[model samples]
Target chain A: MKASEISVGQTFEKVVVEDLKRTQLVMYSGASGDYNPLHTDDLYCKEAAGYPGVFAHGMLTMGMTGTLVTDLFGAENVRKYGVRFTNQVWPGDTLTATATVQDIRDEDGRPVAEIGIETVNQDGKTVVLGSATGLLED
Target chain B: MSDEKTVTFPVEGTHVMMFARSIGDYNPAYHDPGKGEGNPVGAQVAPPTFPQAVAQFDPEYPLRIKDGEAWFGSGGSPSGIEGKPATSGGLHAEQHFEYTRPVRPGDVLTARYSQGETWEKESRRAGKLTFTERLVDYYDQDGNHVCRARGVGVRTERPVDQG
Candidate 1:
């Protein structure tokens, strides 16, 4: 949707990732080179780190959240993006990412849209919370 | 960490595509540069969180979580707090990204990595929490500020039987 078309407080469609799998985390680790044992090696996590099992990488979830904005605004138009990892994400957990338009205004001669981003897990717990802004084309 | 250092990443189309793939993002702009022809940064733009992944290439990365170098009680922590080993892993608390220009393939970018802000907080599970915030400012080959990134990680102790 165009920046002009988006209304303040208007929330876009939610992107839901269901039953998040371990393979996805492994692939992300290989791709991002963030092979922290907490995200892999269940035995190590249970013995050394003292967690139930592996958890998703915060960047992986943040990147997943970014998909919400970039889907509508495109990656290049995203001028600012941010998030706070509020809760842990484990395998089999479902996450939903949403972006609500906070303001649609003109910056200089171009339109800019500020959005509030949030991702919640199945239990209605916020896994990641943050905001973002994108430049809108005329 | 040290004061500051220059970190660079050699951009490649395959890596960009791989990043998009990793996130299961099927955006054409990331795979088919032709879709982004009219955009200012050219086609095949990097995803918004692409720089976070590229941080591994930096030899001077402050917290090597994967290496287990900065684990709690390791004394390698920025806070220099000493304590018994913690059972739980560290957490990535927050992140921020600001961009001046969209990154594209063939664009050589350099980032200055430095510490932002840090503090201590008492926690129930962990004795005390040391939160370290890191920053990276990206510059293009032409020396134009392309983007900036800030990240925060927290270390603390946790119960062994968190099960």
Candidate 2:
């Protein structure tokens, strides 16, 4: 659906937590060429890196949020998407993403909606947060 | 040894678009001019991964490590190891970014990056390995904090035992 059809202050359906994991991290790392040890090395991450276990890459987590936004607003309609990492996501952390319409504006008198997107872990801690802006179809 | 130095650069609309294109994300927000907000005011809105596109550090920085260096340089060969080649022989591995606010056109952005952490380990598939982490911070034209991203990179090489 076009972004124009959606109302302001709307929230999107959250994705399942099972979709988050190490394999996804590995794939993203390979695709993005960011092979950091903290995301992949369990032992090193635990012993030297100072974590309970291996953690997912922050970008992988952010990508998951991006996927959520794209799914809701249609990839073509999204104009701006950005995020900030708040906490580390370890393997097996359950995550759900949500977006709320923040504002709708017109650029050169064109209609656009600004939306806020966030990913929160099972503990209710926000792992990723950002805002996006998109032009509604006329 | 001293901590790895980090450098930051202002964000440019062209650079952001280049990053989005390089990642194959062609969303209208990232590409078309009249599609969203109808403002040819600036480049397309950057993709989620756009911040990583700028070369935040010297390419040769990671290669300057000693043998058996424990963290960054010790995994194997002097030239470093290889697994799946990156878009440019570098993988994304992992990234963490926090956006204090959205980046808009005319907002000059700057990215500062520092070497965060590094280590070595054995992988059953990729064999000996070295890993490095980089932390990046982004700020807008007003110098207001925009976003910060931390990325990890793994370099694989043949183990010395194999030689």
lDDT of 2 by residue, B64-157 (tens): 2234543421133311333322211233345555555455445666666567789888876446667788777777767788777766666555
In model 2 chain A, where is the ten-residue run with the lowest total lDDT? Answer: A43-52
In order of appearance, the predictions have TM-scores of: 0.87, 0.53
Write candidate 1's Cα lDDT for A109-135 as tens digits. 889999998899898889999999898
- Model 2: TM-score, first chain: 0.88
List fnat per candidate, in order. 0.56, 0.04
Instruction: List model 2 lDDT by residue over A11-78, tens digit each.
Output: 88565355356776665545444556555655544444334555675666676677566555554455
What's model 2's overall lDDT? 0.58
Error of 1 at A125 (Å): 0.8
Global lDDT scores for all candidate models: 0.78, 0.58
User: What tens digits encode model 1's per-residue C-alpha lDDT throughout B68-133?
Assistant: 454431222312224424444468889899989788888888888888889999876556778999
